[model samples]
Target: MMPDLPEQKGFLEQEANQFFEESFSGFLIADEKNRIIRSNKRVSAWLGISPEEIKSKKISDILSIGSKIYFETHLSPLLKMQGYFEEILVELNGAAGKRLKILINAKESASKEDGLKLIYYTLVEASDRVQFEQNLQHGKSRAEKELEAERENVILREQLIAVLGHDLRNPLGAISMTVGLLERSIKDERQKKLLQILKRSSYRMNELIGNVMDFARTRLGEGIVISPREIDLKPVLEHVVEELKFLFPDRKITVDIALPEPIHCDADRIAQLASNLLANALTHGNPQSPVSFTASNETNKLELSVANDGEPIPESLQAILFTPFKREGNRPSKNGLGLGLYIADQIAKAHGANLSFTSNEEETRFIFAMEC
Candidate 1:
């Protein structure tokens, strides 16, 4: 390519210089020591200084105290190491103590013979961007604090429930004892019937209390406690099925057990889990069909299942069936507090076992599997 004529070159140079001075952003030319050698018209106007006045002034002179320190300690060293720097945020001090947040870009170019090699800088106003970042940081901090507070509130609520559940046990026991004694002394048939009703209601209340306490214990991070022992689970399974039958005499229950050897387990908790599953089956089973209980203690593992024939549980409800306080849509909410399955599942987990279920138009079954 051939060089342009001098007049034509002068015209292009003038046009380029005009665009550089009148551009929207600020621009500066500084010597190797960071002394301002020249500045564009826009920068001079924004800082309330003429181009002539800005010349020979150190960049530190136009920066806020903090920015001045950062520029010298970090920005300068980084620019020296990399020969280029971009988007380095700095607060520029202007006339009348005004401050402007700006993003700076600095680059080292070829040395000039005219006077000294210079650093070229470009600055963009970043007040809004800085404010946006600050707002984001503030919102993040607020969310974290709120989440922590919510967790504490849940812990406190669980503690209170546990305390209340514990306190009710003594009075409940007294009431149960009194009711039994009253039944023994009563002679009238009607009075005996009333005592029976009282006993039933008391038993139900006691079960509810137990559920609440267990829920509290789990939520408060103290899981269900168990005392494991070597024992045959056949009798335990039979007794639990018998108890459920006694509670709901109208409901038919069938039990099949194959435990011929001792199994290490917490019998009380196992019985509770069995009762819970049976009760659920009774609540939702086909009235004419018998609820089935099956247990097998093979050499490797123990498996127990409770099944009843009825309408299939809704698919959505099945997903959360073992979560606390959630009842199936078709089930009566007034019948119980909706904790039976949840407590049973938790007990299974504590025992290093699993409680699972399957439901269809024909039947719904809750099955427990455990290591022998």
Candidate 2:
């Protein structure tokens, strides 16, 4: 055997080979004149060339258009002037028209025995990352446009409600005043009959005006005040039931007060809530069946359910039942504007209460509950 080499020399060779073979980064070694001397498999694969083909090729010939200019103008000059250079990014074309991003570095070898100065390079693919960034920017732009459009729509709706409410109130006030004066002045039987017709027309107009005002207030975020107090709800439920009984004498309404004691709530709002629920039940419940109103305290909440045996609300319509001005199938002319349930829902929420519903062939219930 030949004389054993020094341990340090053997170790260095092993380290150099390990660095080239195990690295995920593409590496290449070139001579002082920029002629390729050796390259790792990664580098050969990146250029679509075999190790044999890469051995004697010039560095400028192996590089893509962008990388060539950068290496000659910046990397080569720096290595020659400073003896070593660190991480310089460059692009190169790969096999099958692919492009790659690479970091280039160069340094003078520690041993001068071989007349070889090594220029090292590491490559990484950046096309996917670049495309991801571009897509993110595009998505942000689209979301901003949608937000601007939604804001414009809200502003337009508020403006329209304001104009409509103002115009409607003026004519409605005049007609109401005229009807009141005619009721007092008309004395003859025929004139009284005509005055009755005028009064009825004025009443319908007033109802429409009230609906318009309520809708405007809802849109403008007005008319919701919740001041909770300890009050007896039994009297309130009974009063609402009595009022409904008088209003709809043809239909039967029953009030079942399970909680005889007091409960905590905003009394005025709860009264309005009860009235709205009872009215809804009366309007939609079958004439042959009686509308039921039930209230009780359960767990930490005071629960109230107004159920009616009527035509089952379809599954699709249930989602939008609480929406403003949304009505079910056509009914008689006596049905008023669909503001009652929407207002009741708003009032319930303001009091930290939840309003929900369940409907089936046998019964339809609107349930409202508030924590005690």
Q: Best-fitting candidate, measured by lDDT?
A: 1
lDDT of 1 by residue, 163-273 (tens): 998999999899999998998899999998788777877877888898899999988888898899999888888988877786777889987899988889999999989
Off by over 4 Å in 1: 1-19, 113-115
Worst 10 residues of 1 by lDDT: 327-336
Top TM-score hit: 1
Q: How many backbone clashes are present in model 2?
A: 0
> Candidate 2 at residue 309, lDDT?
93
TM-score against truth, every candidate:
0.90, 0.54
lDDT tens readout by residue for model 2, 1-372: 676679978998999899787677777777778788887888778788788888988777777897898788987898789788776666666777776766666776654666545665455555666677789999999999999999889867876866786788788788768867877887899987776667656654654555456566767677566688889888888887886785576888777787766788888778888888887888788889999889888676788899999788877768888888778865442376777788788888888889999999899999998888
| Candidate 2 TM-score over all chains jointly | 0.54
RMSD of each: 2.6, 8.7
